[model samples]
Structure formats: structure tokens, C-alpha cells
Target: MKLLFSLTSLFLLICSTALAYDNEPNGFKGLKWGTSIEEFKNVYPNATLQKQQPGEYNPANIITYIVPINESKLSGITITSPFRYSFYNNKLESVLVTFTGKDNYETLNKQKILLNRMSMIYGEINESSGNNIDEFIPGLSTSYYNFNYCWKGTTTTINLNGSYKEPNLSSYLSISISSVEIRKQWLSKVKPIDKTEWSKIRKNIISEYRSDW
Candidate 1:
């Protein structure tokens, strides 16, 4: 009975996690990941792909687009911003959206709306807060916070971050959604350290022999 109960619990946990990611979000703006550059161009015929890094980099290609600011034109979406897409292995890996404008109550409200929209699709989010300052400019501090949401099925992560300076004059928000598998595959290709070899080196000791001449 105990084993059966444990099995049942495991099944329930798996099901709950699966249900959390009912919508398998791949890309934004009608674009999906794992699509080749040619395929992307077919969708957005005039879209241009810019190479930001060397071919060795995981995200070697990028495309930035400006979204319309007219709320009604965007169908009641006021949080219009530019989106940057990072492509790896000829496939889209991450999408970063930047919300611009002076930091104020209005900006915060828009951010809240964006978060709500994302939550509806990505599920509950894990929120966090932090502080950031310009190292060169002293006394220039800002409040920085972010909401991170993840899905188990696709191992995708979505991060919504906001930063604002004092007096709410300068503020901006950024949203990033990335695929975990793509990141892991790319990161693994970077310079990797051999822990076992490092440990051996750390334990190696030179014998001290006093030579009396």
C-alpha cells in the first residue's frame, strides 16, 4: 500500500506539472522556434536577420522589430515595444522585449498589464526584486525587479524585468523568454572545466628536499 501510494503521488505531481504548461509557447508574434531563417523570412517577407556575434556563439543571429505604439491600432495593447529575437543553430532561442518611456505610475500600470497577460499564458510567476546603480556615476541608484516564470514541459523560462531611477523620471521594462534546452546545449559548448583534473592539481604537492652544497 505504501509503494502504491507513493506511485500515485508521483503520478499526480507529474500530471499537475503537465497541466501547468498546457500551452506550449514556442515563439512570439506568430513565429515559432526551430524554424530556419528562410522560413522566418517567408513569414515576415521584409524582416531582416542581423548577425550580432560570431558563428561560434549560440545566439549568432538577431532581429529587432519596432511594434506600433497606437493602442487602438494594436487592439487595445498599449505596451508597445521593440522585440529582439536571438537565433541559435538556425533556430530561434530567445525573445527580448524592451518597454520604453519615462518611469511613472503609467509605466508601472502598463507593466502590470503585461505581466498579467504573460501569467495567463505562462502560469504563475516567481517574483524577485533587486537594486542597481551605475558604478561610474555615484549616487545614481535605481530599483530593479523581475518576475520569472517557467514551464516544465518545454523547460522554457520567461523573465520580466523593470528598472527605474529616482523621481520616476527614467524607467524601462524588459521581457525575455528563452528555451532551456537551447541554452544548455550552447553553454555546454563553452570552455568547460574538468573537475576531477582540477581536484588532482589542487592535491598535488611538490616534495621539499633541502640540498646542502
Candidate 2:
């Protein structure tokens, strides 16, 4: 009985430690994608963001933020944009940025400003739901764009696309930025779910929303 009790206690301790590390801020807890507007707000309270109403070109909500993590130590940042309708179909767009050494902030800031500008470009269209925005701006393609970010040996690329739409013409954007080194170190120390697991979590959230609608 004594040996069994000791083993049970040890197991509980390990479980508790794992849960603590998993829920830590700036950890993987913050790197989720495809989450709803409400869920995103819960995680990023400091983002001070806003959502636009549906219109001719505008989808639904526009979420923008300057990541709260220490940019200097980050390995990369990824932004995932997913659009779902009252129907069951799901559309996803992703972008990545990798940065290292000096000028990291410059590159990161540039990306940030670009996102903000993009938001403004579509701001009116987003407000009107694509009605007011001109269909042909010379080389312009679509109105919606998705992207991601990461850090490599001082070089980074912000991938983007203008394809995605919501049922009510309302769309969703989820951004996640992290340092590769920090993520690996923390994950190595804790027993959190891997990327596959995290992806499931995101999918489940989307599924739940779909079911509710």
C-alpha cells in the first residue's frame, strides 16, 4: 500500500508540472490558429484590436496587433488566416517570417506596418463588404490576404494571398509569432501536445463554431 501511494503521488506531481508549463504565457498556449474572435480576444488582451462590420467587400472582423513577446529572442512568427461560412467548408492561408541577429526589429516592424497598412487598404471594403472597392486596381487581385512570420539567419519573408471569404462575408484572422529556440526549449522541458495536437485543438474550435451556427 505504501509503495502504491508513493507512485500515485509521483504521477500526480508530474501531471501538475506538465499542466503548469503548458498554460504558461508566451508559451505554445499563445500560438493557436483558427480560433474564433472571442477566443483570440481572451488570449491577447493587450492587442487593443478591433473588428469591422460586414459590407460589400469587407468580410467581418479585422484583428491587428504588435506581438507582445521579446522580438530579439524570437526565432520566427507565423500568421494563419482561416475563413469559414455558415456552410461546412473551411479555407486557410498561412505566412512565415524567420529572423536572426541585428535588424530583427526593423524587419519585424516593417512586417507589422505592412499588416496595418493592408488592414487600412481593405478597411473601407471590409466596412462595405466589397461593394465600394474597385474590382480592378491595375494588377490588384483579391481583397483578402493571409500571411505568417518566422526568424532565420537575419532574413525573413512575409507570405501573403488575397483569397478567403466568410459566409456572412465576415472573415477571421489569427496570428502567432514565436522564437524557434524558446519554443523548442520550453517544449523539451514540458509534456505539452505537439503541432499535430495543437492543430487538432484549432480544428475542434472551428468545428464547434460550425456546429453552433
For model 2, residues 1-213, the per-residue Cα lDDT tens digits are 112112221222111111111112322344433344455446556544323211111121223333344333222333321221110011111112222112222333434554455344323111111222223231233343222321121111122212122121222222222233322333355555467864664455445444332
Model 2 is weakest, by summed lDDT over 10 consecutive residues, at 84-93
Per-model CA lDDT versus the true structure? 0.46, 0.28
Give the Å shift of residue 208 in candidate 1: 52
Report the number of the highest-lDDT candidate. 1
**Model 2, residue 113: C-alpha shift (Å):** 7.3
RMSD of each: 15.8, 19.8
